[model samples]
Target: MQNTAFTTAWRKGVIARYLTVAGATVDLTGCGDHTYYRCTGCGHGTHGVSVIERVARERAQGHAETCRALPRPTH
Candidate 1:
């Protein structure tokens, strides 16, 4: 797996976010004021207030269990 970073940027009048993890690029979708992380690898995602916070929370909550892009064992 590769070291990844989650970032967000403003595109137009909305927030655009993406996550680069283990060589896969996951595009985030925004709904209302919440952002969702959709894994390009496994097609799994969860909603958060921010992309960075979402990814961090997902990882901390053991997203690797279902995330194909991040297959490393979580402890």
Candidate 2:
């Protein structure tokens, strides 16, 4: 399936973000010439940067499917 969940331009270094059903986000960040994804809800994501863009994007999308973590409110 095609992933259209990524939203852009909301934060620096954030290439895209996948907002979960519970309002948590899976963020795709660009690090130098590499890329990595991190989840704000369950805190489950790739441990290190992946040079392959497709792999990283797919991983982020898949994680969003099962993650039901609600967003943490800012103080």
Candidate 3:
């Protein structure tokens, strides 16, 4: 599990990416419970799923919320 601060930051990043036209990629690598997000177009890291989950929990309790879901594949 990730710390509160880290998870919060991760959630913000994911939300931003997901809502943007720039797009972002979310990946679950190996056996890790955490999810990683990367920008496929510019090759930049976005955030992780653990972070998102943390944010979701916080929001359910009346906290504010915040992805960069990467762009589609190119042939």
Candidate lDDT values, in order: 0.45, 0.73, 0.34
What's the true lDDT of residue 30 in model 2?
79
Candidate 2: the clashing residue pairs are none
How many pairs in model 1 have backbone atoms within 3 A of each other, for residues 3 or more apart or on separate chains, i.e. clashes? 0
lDDT of 3 by residue, 1-75 (tens): 422323323434343223223333332222223434444434444244444544433322221111333345554
Write down the TM-score of every candidate.
0.34, 0.73, 0.27
Any residue pairs clashing in model 1, and if so which? none
Q: What tens-digit string does per-residue lDDT give for candidate 1 at 1-75?
A: 334343323334333334443534455555443555555456556544444545544542354343446423324
lDDT of 3 at 53: 42
lDDT leaderboard ranking:
2, 1, 3
Write model 2 residue lDDT over 1-75, tens digit each, in one string. 332244323567888787776667898887544888888888887767465667777888888887898655544
TM-score head-to-head 1 vs 2, winner: 2
Candidate 3: C-alpha lDDT: 0.34
Give the higher-lDDT candidate: 2 or 3.
Answer: 2
